[model samples]
Each structure stands twice: as C-alpha cells, then as structure tokens.
Target chain A: MSKKRDDIIDTTSDLLERQGYFATGLNQIVEESGAPKGSLYYYFPGGKDEICEEAIRRSGASLEKSIDRAMSEADTAAEGIAALVEGISRAMEASNFGAGGPLTTVATETAGQNERLNNACEEIYESWRATFERYIRKDGIDSIRAERLSTLVLATMEGAIILSRTYKSTEPLQRAGAELRELLEFAR
Target chain B: MSKKRDDIIDTTSDLLERQGYFATGLNQIVEESGAPKGSLYYYFPGGKDEICEEAIRRSGASLEKSIDRAMSEADTAAEGIAALVEGISRAMEASNFGAGGPLTTVATETAGQNERLNNACEEIYESWRATFERYIRKDGIDSIRAERLSTLVLATMEGAIILSRTYKSTEPLQRAGAELRELLEFAR
Candidate 1:
C-alpha cells in the first residue's frame, strides 16, 4: 500500500475503534489521516464505506499475524490463551482503553446495516475461531469440541475487551482468562 | 420519569443501541423523538450529554430488573444463564439484530470520552456482574469462584451478542450458552 493509503487506513481504524462506524466522518478521516482528498478518492472511490471495508480487512489480517505469533510463543494451548488474554489487556491499557480496535465498534454499528462491512467482520471472526480451534486441536481435543471451545473462547475474549475498556481495568480480562484456562485445562 | 422525559430516554437509548454515541446527533434525537424542543430542554437542560447520561442509567436499571426476573425464573445457575442467553437471542432476533440494546454500543463508544456515560456503563456492568455472582453463589460456589465465573459469563455474553449480530444468527449465542453450561456443570 502507498504511504498515503496506509495513513488513511491507520487513522480511520483508530477513529472507528474509538468512536464507531456511523459516528466517524469522512472529513475527520481526511483531516486526521493527513491523506490528501484527491489521494483518498484515488484509492477509495466508494467513500467511507469502501475505506471502512479495507480498514477491517487490513486490521483482521494484522491481528491474525499477531495471534499466530503469540500462539507460537507458548508451549501449551492454555498458556497461549493466557498470553493472548493478557496481551489484550495490555494493548487496551496502552491505547487508553481504546481496545477492540475498529473491529468491535464497526461490527456492532454496521452488522446488519451494511453488507460489505458485515461480511468482513464475519470473515474475520471465522478466521479467529479457526485459529483458536487449531490451537485447541493440538491439545488432542476432539474436532467438534475444539471448534465449540474455540468459539466460546473468542466470544469471551471479545466481551472481556468491552468490559475491560468500559471499566478501565484489566481485572475482567484477567478473571476471564483464568476461567478459560480452567476450561482448557479440563480438556487436557 | 415524565412522559416527555421517557420519550427522550427511549429514543436516545434506541439511537445509542443502533448507532452508538458519537454517531447519534442531537438533531436526530429531537426529530426522531418528536418531543417538543422546549420539553427536551426543560427535562434535560444540559442537552445531548444529559440525555445520554439519563438514557444509560435508565437502560441499566431496566436491564437489572430483567436480569433479576430471568434469574428468578430459573432453578439453577446453569438454567438461569441458559434462559438469559436464549432470551437475548430472541430479543435480538425480534428487533432484527439490534441486540446490544444500550450496553455494548454505548459502552464501547463512550468508555473513555465522556465521564458521565463511562461511569453509567461501569455501574451497569458492575450490577450485571453482581447479579450473576449472586446466582453462582446460591449454587454453593465459593465467593471467589462465583465472582470469577460471573465476570467470565458477562464477557462471554457480550462478545457472543456481537458475533450473533455480525453473523445475523443465534448460533454464536447458543454455542456460548452451551459452553457456559459445561463450565457450570463442572462446578456442580
């Protein structure tokens, strides 16, 4: 991606993460991104919706890489999940509680309203579930149970991010991590 | 609340639920609400911020009542949680996937920007955790375990709602309920 286009996605993702899709305006995106209006139009002619779709896709890919890296660092599935949970807490704290990135806020705002964004979110979620399922499967869990546990873990982490952001504390995420670790340990 | 105030809260809550705080405008509030301009100011002199604050509080209280009612109807902690999860899927489906209602959207949108709204969300979340904790405790779980389980359950539900909305299906929620039921049964 061009520097200008990357800047646009970076800023728009931040805005959507902090505010939401419907609340983020094109003017704000241009102003904050410092991307020339002509360049933005050149890259994304479909306006905010087009820009948002790219943002979601790019963010999702970036997150998948991060999850892969995090999972690789741990020897066990439980440890991998624990690291992921704590990493989320630290990221939220670092961003000053602007966690969930653009994903959660945009997903909620455009879930049924916009087909393109909704599809992006759905694909992102499916990718995440599959990733977790792979980790759990490594622990010898049955494919069906691994898939189900993966879904539950993903849902819990997403929800914990929301709570952690809302309460401005890592306690919720930590507790949620412990709970998940117990569940995964049971499988072991 | 007076009829005029109630109208404002209801309308504002709906807007917050669907689009979130930054995207929901005062003009839209007044126009969609059909409440007299004078009445809006008379009821909430501080304008949109005040209205949002009230909306958060009122919505929180209403949800707390619903939680209490749902808990009352179930004999065991697992049953209560299952009923609550199914109820959420039903409500979201009925509303055509506007499931987060006031909590998920508003909390994410205003977690750090506005003190009043953030505090209201915190209180609402704390109340919800407490409600779940009470049920877990009633099942003879230790206080520490109950509290941890309560937080996990809350996070899972909030995350599941987002997935359910994004996928336009109740499967995420149903799967989440199954996961939580397994955890609760293990505790028993």
Candidate 2:
C-alpha cells in the first residue's frame, strides 16, 4: 500500500485504540495523519467504516505476528503466553494505558450495531485464537483442549487489558499472566 | 429516586451497554427513555457524564447482587462462577447479543479520556473484584491467591463478554466459564 494509506491506517488504529470508533472523526484522522483531506476519500471511498475496517485488520495481523514470534521464542506455551502478556503490560504502561486492545473498544461498541465492522472484529479475534490454538497444540495438547484453552486465553487477555487500562495499572495484566501461565502448565 | 430518574438511568444503561458513551447522545436517551427533554438536565445537572456515571453504578450494583445471589446458591466458588457466567450467556442471547458487560464498553472507551467516568468504572471493577476475592477466600484460599484469582476471573469474564457479543455467540463465555471452573477446582 501507499505510504499515505499506511499512515492513515496507523493513525486510525491509534485513535481507535484510545477513543473508540464513533469518537474518532475523519477530520481528526486527516489532521493527525497529515495526509491530504482528499486522500482519505481517494484511498477509502467507503469512508470511516472502510478506514476502520482496514485499521482493525492491520492491528490484528500485527498482533498475530507478535504472538507468533513470542510463541517461537519461548520453550513452553505457558512461558510464551506469560511473555506476551508482560509485553502488553509494558506497552500499555508506556502509552499511559492509551494503547493495547486496538480492536476491543471497536468490537464492543459495534458488536450488534454495525455488521461490517463487527464482522471484521470477529474475524480478527478468530485469527488470534487460531494462532494461540496452533501453538498450544504443539505442546502436545489435544485439538479440543487446545481450542478451548486458546479461547480462554484470548478472553482473559482482552478482559485484563480493559481492567489494566481502566485502573491505569499493570497489576491486572500481570495477575492475568501469572494465572494463565499456571493454567497452561496444568494443561500440559 | 423518582420513577423518572430511575427510568432515565435504566435507559441510559441499556444504551451505554450496547452503543457506548459518545455514540449515545442525550437526545437519543431522552427520546428512547420517553422522559421530558428538560428532565434529563434536571435530573443530571452535569449532563451526559453524570448520566453515564449513574448508569455505570447502577449496572455494577445489580451485577454484584447477582454475583452475591449466585454465590450463596452454589456450593463451591467454581460452581458459583459457572452459574454466574452461564446466566450472563443466557442474558446475552436473550438480548440478541445487545446486552452483557454494561460497563465494559464505557469502561474501555473512557478509560483515560474521561476522568470522572473512568473513576466510576474503576470503583465498580474494584467492587466486583472484592466480591469475588471475599468468596474465594472463604473457600480456604489464602488472601493473596484469592485476590489474584478474583482479578483473573473478572478479566476473563469481561473479555469473554466482548467476544460473545462480537461473535453473536455465547460459546466464548461458555468456554471461559468451563476453563475458570477447572482453574478454581484445581485451586481447591
């Protein structure tokens, strides 16, 4: 994609991560992205929905890549999940709890209201679960257990992000990580 | 509170539960609640923020009561949690995925942007955690472990609600309940 398009998506993802969907205006995206106002329509003719859909997809893919790398680096699924949650905690703190959960706010805000955006979020979440399931399966877990465990892991991580962000503390994420680590170890 | 005030809060909570903060305007609230337009400002002098704060508190208190009742009815912490989650799943389905996590969208959407609302959300979350911590401690768990487990339970429930809403399926919540049950059982 063009640099302008990438910049727009990056800015939109950041804004969505913080303020959510409806609060994020196209004017704000144009101003923050420093891309020409006309370029937004030029690239995303579907307007805010298209821009947001692209942003969610991009954020989801990036996080999936991070999970893949984290899983590959650790010796066990438990350790990999621990490291992943820890990294999220640090990033959230670094951003003053403004980052993390790029898709969470959007997903919740649009769940039943906006079908197109809702579908995008559902797809992203499924991909993340699939990534976790693939790694947990490598740890000698049965397919069924791995699928269930992956869903729990994703739900915990998503929910912990909300708490950590709300409390403006990393403790929720840390506690979640520790708990998930234990759960994974027990599963193995 | 007057019946009108209660009506406003109830309607605002429903709107906030589904569409989030910014998306649910005062006009929409008034229109949907069928309360006089002037009555909104009369009831909540601080406007939308005040309305949202009350809505969050009401939702939190109601859910806490549900937790209390669920706990009292169950024989184990795991069973109580399972029942609570199962109830949430059924409610979500009943709302056609338009309900559940009454505070979640607002909590995440206003985490850092709106201080007053964020603090309300934080207090509600703390209350929920305390309820869980107290019950878990009663189950012969140490204070520290109870606290950690309570936080995990809250986070997983919040995250699972988001997934269930987005996917328009209660499977995520059901799966989360099952995993949490196993984790609590192991703790015992």
Candidate 3:
C-alpha cells in the first residue's frame, strides 16, 4: 500500500477501536492521518466500508500476532494465556480503556445491519479464534477440546475487555486471566 | 411514565440494541415510536443521552428478570445458566441475529467517549453481574468463588452473543453454555 493509504488505514484502525465505525468519520480519519482529503476515495474506491473492512482485517491480524508472541514467550499454554490477558489489561489501562476490542463495537453495530462489514468482522474473529485454537492444541489437547477451550478463552477475553473498559478498571481482565489459567491447567 | 414516554423509551431500547447509540438517530426514534416528535424533549429533557440511559436501564432490568426466571425454573444453577444461554441463542436466531446483547453496542460505542452513557452501562452491567452472583451463591458456593464465576459467566455470555451474532450461527452461544455448565458443575 502507498504511504497515504497505510496512514489512512492505521488511523481508521485506531479511531474504530476507540469510537467504532459509525462514530469514526472519514473526515476524522483524514484529519488524524494527515492524508489528503481526495486521496481517501482515490485509494479506497468503496469509501468508509472499504476503509473499515481493511482496518478491521489489519487490526485483527495485528492482535493475532500479539497473541502468538505472548503465547510463545511463556512456559506453558496456561501461563501464556494468562500473560496475554495481562498484556490486554495493561493496554486497556494505558489507553484509558479505549484501546482493546478493536472489532467488538463494529461487529455488534453492523452484525445484521451491514452484510459486508459483518462478514469482515466474522472473518477477523474466526482468525483470532483459530490462533487461540492453534496455541491450545499445542498443549496436547484433542482437536474438539481445543476448539471449545479456545472459543471460551476468546469469548471470556472479549467480554472481559468490555467490562474492563466500562468499569475503567483492569480487575475484570485480571480476574478473567486467573480463571482462564486455572481452567487451562485443569484441562491439561 | 406516560404511554408516549414509554413508547419512546421502548423504541429507543430496541433501536439502541440493533443499531447502537450514534447510529440510532433521534428522528428515527420519534418516527418509529409514532410519538409526537415534540414530546421527546418533553419526556426526556436531556435528549438522546437521557433517552439512551433509560433504555439501557430498562433492558438491563428486563434481562435480569429473565435470568431470575430462568434460574427459578431450573433445579441447578448450572442448568439455569445453560438455559439462559440457550434462550439468548434462540433470541438471536429469532431476531435474525440482531436482538441479543442490547447493551453491548451502546456500551462499546460510548465507553470512553460519553461519560453519562458509560456510567449507565457500568451500572447495568454491575446489576446484571450481581444477579448472576446471587444465583451462583445460591448453589452453596462461597462468596469469592461465586463472584469470580459469575463475572466469567457474564463475560462469556456477552462474548458469545457477539460471536453468534456475527457468524449468524448459534453454535458459539451453545458451546459457551455447555462449557459454562461444566465449569459451574465442577465448582459445585
């Protein structure tokens, strides 16, 4: 992608994470990204949906890598998962509870209302879940059990992010991480 | 509340659930509710935030009652939670994946940007969590464990609702429900 295009997508990703799709106007993206106004449509011919779809995909892949890195740094699946949650908690606090759940608000907002954006969100969430599944499977878990456990972990983390953000406290994420660690250890 | 006021709040609740705070315009709420447009500001002197806050509280209380009813009907806390999740799954399917998680979109959309709405969301979520904590405690579990487990249950359900809506599939909620039942049983 061109530098301006990348800037636009990057800005969109951050705006979407903090304010969601409808609330994050293209003008704001241009203003924050310092991309020329005309360049937006020139680069993303489909307008806001296209820009948001790209942002969601980019954010999703970025978070997947973070999950992978967190998983790799720890000694075991349980510890890795706990560390990942801790990292998310810290990020949430750092952003003043505006940073986490990049796809959550968009997913919920557009689920039935906008088919294309909904599809993009579904794809990203599936990719994240698969990343978690891959990590869980490394613990010698059967495929079925791993799949279910990964889904639970993703769901819990996603939910915890919302709660943590709303309460302006990392306690929810911290509590979730502890519970997930216990569950993962038990599963092993 | 007058019938017109109730109608406005009810319409706002449904609109917020499906489309979120920013996307659900005041004009749409007036048109859909069929209440006199002038009456909106009369009933809710504070305008959109006031309307949305009332809607969130109403929806939250309604869901809490559903939880209480589900718990009352089942013999075990595990069974009741499973049933509650199942009901939420059916509701999602019934609405064509647009109805579940009434507070999720609004909560996420307004989390950091709107203090009044954010506090409304925090209050409702806390109320729901307390309800879950109560039922979990009734299972003879200790307070600390019940608190943690209830938070997990709430988070998992909230996340599953998002996934199920995005995928247009009920499997995520069902899987979360099954896993939650097992976890609750294990705890007991």
The per-model DockQ list reads 0.77, 0.91, 0.82
lDDT of 3 at B165: 89
For model 2, residues A1-188, the per-residue Cα lDDT tens digits are 69999999999999999899989999999999999999999999999999999999999999999999999899889999988987888899899999976799999899988999999999999999999999999899999899899999999999999999999999999998899999999999
The prediction achieving the highest DockQ against the true structure is 2
Going through the candidates in order, the fraction of native interface contacts each one reproduces equals 0.79, 0.88, 0.69
Report the Cα lDDT for residue A130, model 2. 94
Candidate 2 chain A least-lDDT 10 residues = A93-102
List candidate 1 segments past 4 Å from native: none
Q: Model 2, residue A16: what's the lDDT?
A: 96
Q: Candidate 3 on B1-188: residue-level lDDT in tens?
A: 59999999999999988888889999999999999878998899999999989998998999989998998898888999988988888888888888985699988898988999999899989988888888888889999888898889889889988999899999888877887888888888
Assess candidate 2 and give its TM-score to the true structure.
0.99
lDDT by residue (tens digit), candidate 1, A1-188 = 58988999999888888787877899999899988888889999999999998888888898887787787788878899998887888888888787667798888877767888889999999998899889889899999888779989989988998899888989999999999999999977
Candidates ranked by DockQ: 2, 3, 1
TM-score ranking of the models: 2, 3, 1
| Candidate 3 ranges with C-alpha deviation above 4 Å | none
Listed for every candidate in order, the interface RMSD values in angstroms are: 1.1, 0.6, 0.8
Model 2 spans > 4 angstroms off: none
Q: Give the distance in Å from residue A132's predicted Cα in candidate 3 to where it truly belongs.
A: 1.1
